[model samples]
Target: MGSFHAMHIETRVTGFIEENCYLVSNPDTQEVVVIDPGDDAADLAARLRGQNFKVVAYLLTHGHVDHISALADLCADFPAPIHIHPADAAWCFTEQNAILGLYPAPRKPDCPLVDATEGMVFELAGASWTVLETPGHTPGCICWKLDAANALFAGDTLFRDSAGRTDLPGGNPRALTQSLRKLAALPDDLRVFSGHGELTTIGREKRENFFMQF
Candidate 1:
């Protein structure tokens, strides 16, 4: 498929875990979408201070604390509605989950949280995106596929050479394996921007990622 326009992508590694927060924008139009604003709200805000981009929405790949630590802060600063899968939204606001024990306090998004369903389509940064239900890292883990840009925001599902750990709550090895298979079947040239670590291509992952073999 041909791209409608060129999209510029900037990755910000945030939080103690070094999670990646992606700023996707259409340079020509200055429309932007913020993905997984992990932490370091001050830094995030500073980065966008002089930017001419208009934030359309905030997209969450999953509800993991590390990936959402700065959700409330970012929303407070940008005032954009957040989109996340319903399954993970249930545990996202509470500190009852095992992973929440690691954090000092529970986080509640300051902005409205919208449920994102598989196959849902939305436009951002002048490109159309299709939501893919790729679970296993969490019950509601999702990947946003921007076919026009040939990019996928894969949140802790299928990483560079490894997959998200299944020992955490809601994690299922079998489900992860199935999810990997689903991702592996996508176009080889699709660029993968994962929750953590460097960006990778589907082709490289299919050939080198051990999880893809499953």
Candidate 2:
């Protein structure tokens, strides 16, 4: 088993929305996985240029354009499968479910796009990630939990003091509420690295997040 001490996480604020893209790595082996590569492909590429980290995969928390804007470009540079919920596949690859006309016709990914489902486990950066289907922000929104590191990559579903907006296409208030509750039920010490804001913890969100009140 890989030790959590060897796992390191780096965050990059990218795109117009300043979305947080995470690079989780195992310093010992220099293996990494990128989450939510929203735009600024050049910057992201530059960060990995001399790092000598072997990118194993790209994980998407959801299909929103802002979280996946750099998909095509990144895949071109580092060939790796993309793990995302099937419900958001179209939104990620094509522009079928895009909202607000914010994205152009996205190019299909050069690498394979795989479905991310609940209970599915995969290894990356010397850590095992378990998928949790926490839909609501979008029909296919999901979260990745690295139990070894006690870290959860919660895309846009749950934020620091607030939750994701349910007014977008396929958004559901009730579903989102349930999702928040599910996340809030996690271990308090679990660190949450969201898509667009500061890092938080399950316990902190439980006590401070208004949406978690449900």
Candidate 3:
């Protein structure tokens, strides 16, 4: 875990796919933002309870089940607001989102879901984050940008050495290309916290990641 911009950020790899669930908190106040609580709900919730931090919200990059499967269960314990792009929010919790012989549908949560729109600014604890719409892997794929931390929560939209796949339901190759163009334009110093895999910086990906090069 690293403390950047006066906040402590911890990543927990969960579930069979080893999805990354991030807990970002202010070191002093302990107010936290739970990003992409994918799976292993019980353990995640328990850890949160153990810390006793105030959960301000749950942020979803898109509504893919692997990235949001534990959202409902975690909300049951934390009861914080959820934020996801409207396009993805439409069917994320439905049976249509389930994977055959693998993951099941995520339960709709008691917490309300706030729309995560393009250019939206989230002022949390003491820092600000801007929402960058990067729809491709899913219709509502997004990346959360925290200028203070110089960090981007890339989710499935981006990864190390590659980017998100555009072969699933609602996938669009052209749209993803456009999204990559947008991300490629950003400064290279921002460190990327992807939905899966290890950490990487925008500079590194821009140089090594073929998708970012395009």
Candidate 4:
């Protein structure tokens, strides 16, 4: 019953980075938000239209290129504000060299960006989500949690059997450990929806994720 009204998170691999673009919507309001419109701007928009959604904003868990390559295109389609963690905002264009130095083209300036903080709560599609500051893969990386749905939009942070690599720029092994600890504390029933890869439950990860102790 609880999952009935829970926000819908749809994933599509678009553009050059192979980043997953998630369309989160409130079934009740038909209002939607796009998370990390990584590359396929047109595809994401088409999908949104097919669902009869009123997209209100584009939220980025971080500013990595693969996660934001199609951000400009998405902003044009939805005409919404672009939100990201302040720490990773600069990465939007700078592509600062770090362990994540290698990958798609260097990031270039394109869209208007906004900063979000931990504990910040916002309403969308008649529901609310808590922003968790879970940085490890990137200094400003985060995960959005919708407690009502027992779901988490974990960017490149925690995965099913493993966690994001800290070998890239702005990554810190110690920080990732701390982030994993925090995620591990969530209820086992919670479903983790990551930026990339298959979705898994917190309980499943806790039991088998070797990188993090459940």
lDDT of 4 at 174: 91
Residue pairs that clash (backbone atoms under 3 angstroms), model 1 = none
The C-alpha stretches of model 3 lying farther than 4 A from their native spots are 1-3
TM-score of each: 0.94, 0.96, 0.96, 0.88
Which candidate ranks first by TM-score, i.e. highest?
A: 3
Model 4 per-residue lDDT tens digits across residues 74-188: 6666677677899888655663522254345434435566677899987766667679999889999989887766788898898778899898778899999999999989888
Q: Cα lDDT of all candidates, in order?
A: 0.85, 0.87, 0.89, 0.77
Which ranges of candidate 4 are over 4 A from the true structure? 1-6, 95-112
Worst 10 residues of 2 by lDDT: 97-106
> What's the best-to-worst order under TM-score?
3, 2, 1, 4
lDDT of 4 at 92: 57
- Writing each residue's lDDT as its tens digit, candidate 1 over 83-167 gives 9999999887776543533554447867888889999998766788889998898889999998877899998997899889989
Tens digit per residue, CA lDDT, model 2, 31-110: 88999998898899888877987889999999888888888998899889899999888565665645465666567778
Which candidate's lDDT is highest?
3
In model 1, the worst 10-residue window by lDDT is 97-106
